[model samples]
Target: MSDAVDPRRASAALLALGAIGLWGTLAAISTRVTAVPPFLLTGLALLMGSLVGFKAFRHKPPPAAALALGVYGLFGFHFFLFLALRLAPPVEANLVNYLWPLLIVVLAPVIVPGIAWSTRHGIAALVGFSGAALLIASSAGSLGQGAWLGYAFALASAVIWSTYSLATRRFSHFPTGYVAWFCALSGVLALACHAIFEPSYVPKAPEWPFIAALGFGPMGLAFFLWDRALKRGDPRALGNLAYLTPLLSTLLLVLFGGGALTPLSIVAMVLILGGAILGSRK
Candidate 1:
């Protein structure tokens, strides 16, 4: 049993790593499509992501409650995130939004009955957040005094995502394929919001590639992998691993000409790695 369990745990970590790595590319890719409206971008990319569910389409659907929870997570998180980005300085909004991981580590016990929170878990989470804050703060400017609404929205995004992630474990009996419907339904809701609020504009030819990449990778396959990872792995450990996203994203941004890497980034990387390692301890 030990032999079998070890491999499963290893696979879960790898899967979580893969998902996080793909997410690392999100900032880099989004930079190229700045002209696209947020809602439309979300709608199109998520619609494309829904293709992953084609094979699962014929499977008996999960319960309505399950699908609703999925939509709440997928749509709700992005909805508030875009609002935060729109209303606040993008960097500040993003830093606030990244609180989801820490929330996960801290709130897991309350949300999931069998999970236990430890003092080490709290320390690991703060250490990881400190690393993320340092990394993100390196790019941010002075905080906007008047962007309270945006900050609130950013906080809401964090709460939505963290709760959604924890709630997913409650519904683990639902097939992973149901994620397709989740994506599809979420895409529809996004598009509907886009139609109702945002000015309509067609995506240009050059933008399709980036949109496809977003759909197929971070916003697409990443969700499926995340679901699998959470189902098989400890969410507390996975939460720490999530801190790597910002560090990796910053590096990718530097690679894509979005920014320059600094010595601080190296330090941030170390803190994040150390926290993840410490948090993963049994």
Candidate 2:
């Protein structure tokens, strides 16, 4: 085969990066709406994400199976994360959840046949994960104590997301627009969970813009971009690139929230960038 990169794959990588960049903004935007309960916030953001579906209404609806998969991925990932955060030390829980990217890198070959795994891929994933873990650990010193159940929930979130993304490849024919429906249905489910398990709190006017940013960026367009990326790009490369999210998120915090970066963060940046470059190689 020629050494030149496939145009479709290149485009897919860019889309994946776009998705990751949006996701990086989640923490920053979420800080602005801390008053909203988790489930309520999720519900509102996802509902806002459903706006993307409006344009796709005339297109053929996704199959029930695809919709189910989407729901399982979207709703399950967030639900499990909520449980993890509530049941354990938030920092620890989040760290455990970040395992999804590594899972994606390692599981790609098994989940999607003919996608070969290599030593470089494994090393890249490990290095990237280490960087992400360091960044997360440095953000807030961990209490180092969490319920085992909470850890399990965090692990489940990772598994759900990795499997969801890989399994999405099985339904590559589904339109990217289907994610809008996924957001709509998932939003309803999240709201119902909020109504049942949490207190109701209407978002204040000032919080609306942040909520909209959350919806339109991280929760909304990111999914579409991710779906397109997974369907078209090499999952291993995308997975390696995903390690940048937490680092980017931390940078956003420093830039916008007046937090200062430390030497450790600089080291983390080098590790993550190096890993990403290695994994992106042909």
Candidate 3:
């Protein structure tokens, strides 16, 4: 494993930032497209993303390992994430799903040889989890039985995503464009699952653009950029940047009347961002 930063790391950071920002805004957009069922929206997004990914793939083909990684990404991460969102509120779903970084931290020592855990990292994780707890308690009133189920789904999603991230290292020799193809393939699989298990789903005319946004903006380009970044940068650094999603989403919620930005949210943001920074440090 190389510790040297790639010159392209800056560009990858920018792309990751854009992706996280778009993902943060997904809840708002999805709300507007309520007429579109979650399954249909996910399926459409995956299908559209696959089209983009396939075009990229034509430029370069990935190894069997990369494709295998993508298969896990589809069935494990995306599928569970969509299901979680369907079962819970976006905020809750995101909070649960984002726990993957912590999962990765715990698994890294076992998966990545010679990686050692430190007391500092443990403290940082504790702080981050505390912040997450505050956020959950602050918004606890919004959750219900369905949201609880979504939390379960979201936790499962975190586990799957952590696995995907860890396993992807095996495919690092493949081109980033090839990795993009695998992501697209994952999306395609997600669509197939949607079609099989979630029949009778149809999006109204007004919902088309929202579905399109999910596909092209977040699902398509975001995944591509993320994979490219991970290829050139440290996963922990990327994970640190990923913490911005919750902070950004909270801001979006305040702007859109989802909730008032309370003192607890402010405190939580500090904890999450601070922890992320500490945890990602070399």
Candidate 4:
């Protein structure tokens, strides 16, 4: 088990917050980056993140377990995530994907062993799901075939992300940077796959800046913070933090001139935030 009071927890929380915020902006930015294929963008971001994480590799090589964990973290979790984003709006996709926190609630006892399920978890799940349902229902009328497909991909991403979270616990001894590198390697592998199958794909000069932003902000720094959080805090505790994504995304959407805050959305946000805070407390 991880020691309590690990300073990395705070850092991770901040990173995760920043990541979600960047992710919220992805929809707005991705529309402009349409010149680049999603796979290429994903690959480039992974490469950038890997480059950022290279400093960690200089000290010592990551072990096999860390490498494996990193692979899933980078490739499995992110590949599906990119796929989902390609198919759906970033805010909608994220709200659905954030369901992983609920999944974590269901799986935590089994994965973490000693941690017992509690009423607090149940209440949190109810509140989170209620919020999610409200959001989905509010947006349901606007969805198309592609959006539905994206929702499916988002759900799949959630499952993979939850599994990745469980897997990370196995390599508790690995340095955060080492784990980040492994994640980058996974991103590299995904990029390689994309290159082989989609040789024609390339980003134009205009899109390069957004691509760079994706790399440094969401892909690179975000993962580093997430890894640190997972190392320092309980997965279940961190999982509750997933609620922040939807809340933040909704707010960002409004700020970006997407839509006015509907009554239902406001109610949903209250429920999600309330549930997450309650669930996070010991």
Candidate 5:
């Protein structure tokens, strides 16, 4: 067991929770700001995140770690996520993307030698996916309506996010603020992509607040908190904690005018949260 008094663990718990909290609000926020092109939105959001996290870059990381950052940064993860959004409903795309948390749990011990591992994690992981399956089934009819490509993008987003999170472990020693640098690099990359593929579009005045909030909160502070937490806290616990994000996100959506919560979604939430707690237990 981890020491409760350990400052690092406490910090990690707080940071992780903070990230999850902000992330829960994302669906509601994004839905309201559909006026902006996804790619351009990605670039602008990341640019803001970069600015918010800019001070952390002073610590600086080595070259190989920097390479990993460029790949996994906003450019890689957000790009895929937004692309997924372009193709499908937020419910489906987000659920598929939730695969990252479970992947983090599964991959933790493999990447970090001293971390604990167990078969129960596999069982819990399946349960988590099963919850996601239930969600998909309930909403399954929403699929195959010309969103197959979107579905593919959503799954890919999951894979990319999972891989990116695990890969960051390799260079965890780098300052957490260095994430700003990654955000900046990703912003640049995203900007280039936007310039090439997306026509220029400006956000209406009403859209600015939502867009700015996304840049500074979820994309910015949440990422820094996640990096710091992962570097200091137990991955296993953090992974289990991540199970809450989807449930919370969905609830936020309903409350924020996105939609009503479904009976099936409640059932799915039970399975997901239950599986996460049970399977993640030592």
Candidate 6:
């Protein structure tokens, strides 16, 4: 085979794209899934992810990792995000959640000892928050009286996810093979929440499509592809490829969710993404 058709390179490229495609479509899916309670949806999607990830399961995680996963997987970003989806419009919710990457740039040093803060991260933080301000400001006029609750959860999703990202780095000895367990455990938590809160609601066939999409794609194969890409490919190129996620995600939301792009939203996207890239520079 020609060098251009190298098996490893081809597979990596395809997997990376698949992961990106799944993530990009999630907000659009959220629009169609409003009738589902966040936790109930989480339980089903994570159960599906768990089923696909069973091959990667090993023994249960160590105690500290398990504790962390309780927060990280069950009651943290994974949970908060789906809840945010229910609380806010998909576009606004997703934009706020995008702050996690910028937060991660700022937070990594705090979680990982010996890593020093840098001017680039400071710039990224400033720029990222400026964009965030515009996003909130732009949306403020028409926000429902109690919509802050949703926005708050949206911001919480970023903080929780950033913490989880940092925690994973801190607990480097934890086995990545335990992803299946994490999903399964998170599914259990979601199931409990569903039992308590959504007993009266019954799922129809339409809702299953969104839940299943999240399970098989973003929650399942995307993670597998991310691990494979990091191990087999050029890190810098993959990192650059990762940048496409936000823009594509936003594009997908606009295209499929029937969302509009106000001038402020457009500007906010540019600033947030620009700030993140600037800050992420080593």
Predicted structure 1, TM vs. truth: 0.95
Off by over 4 Å in 1: 1-5
Relative to the true structure, candidate 4 reaches a TM of: 0.82
In candidate 5, stretches whose alpha carbon ends up further than 4 angstroms from where it belongs are: 1-7, 57-64, 85-93, 136-141, 145-152, 279-282
**Full-model lDDT for every candidate:** 0.88, 0.90, 0.70, 0.72, 0.74, 0.65
- TM-score of model 5 relative to the true fold? 0.86
Better of 4 and 6 by lDDT: 4
Give the per-residue lDDT of model 2 (tens digit) for 28-74: 89989888999999999998987866787677778899899989999
Give the runs in model 3 whose Cα sits over 4 Å from its true position: 1-12, 59-61, 82-94, 142-152
Highest-scoring model, lDDT: 2
Q: What is the C-alpha lDDT profile of model 5 across 46-85, one tens digit per residue?
A: 8898788666666655376565665575577777777787
RMSD of each: 1.7, 1.2, 3.6, 3.9, 2.9, 5.5
Error of 6 at 158 (Å): 3.1
Total backbone clashes of candidate 1, pairs 3 or more residues apart or in separate chains: 0
| Displacement of the residue 15 alpha carbon in candidate 3, Å | 4.1
Q: State the local distance difference test value for candidate 6.
A: 0.65
TM-scores vs. true structure, each candidate? 0.95, 0.97, 0.82, 0.82, 0.86, 0.73
Expressed as tens digits, the lDDT of each residue in 1-282 for candidate 1 is 543456666788899999999999998999989999889999898988878777877877778998998899999999999998888888789889989999999889998879997888788888999999889878765555538899999999999999988888766787778889899899999999999979998999999999999999999999999888888888888898899999899889888788887788778888988888888776
lDDT of 5 at 31: 89
Q: Using TM-score as the measure, which candidate wins? A: 2
Q: Count the backbone clashes (under 3 Å) in each candidate.
A: 0, 0, 0, 0, 0, 0
C-alpha displacement of 128 in model 2, angstroms?
0.3
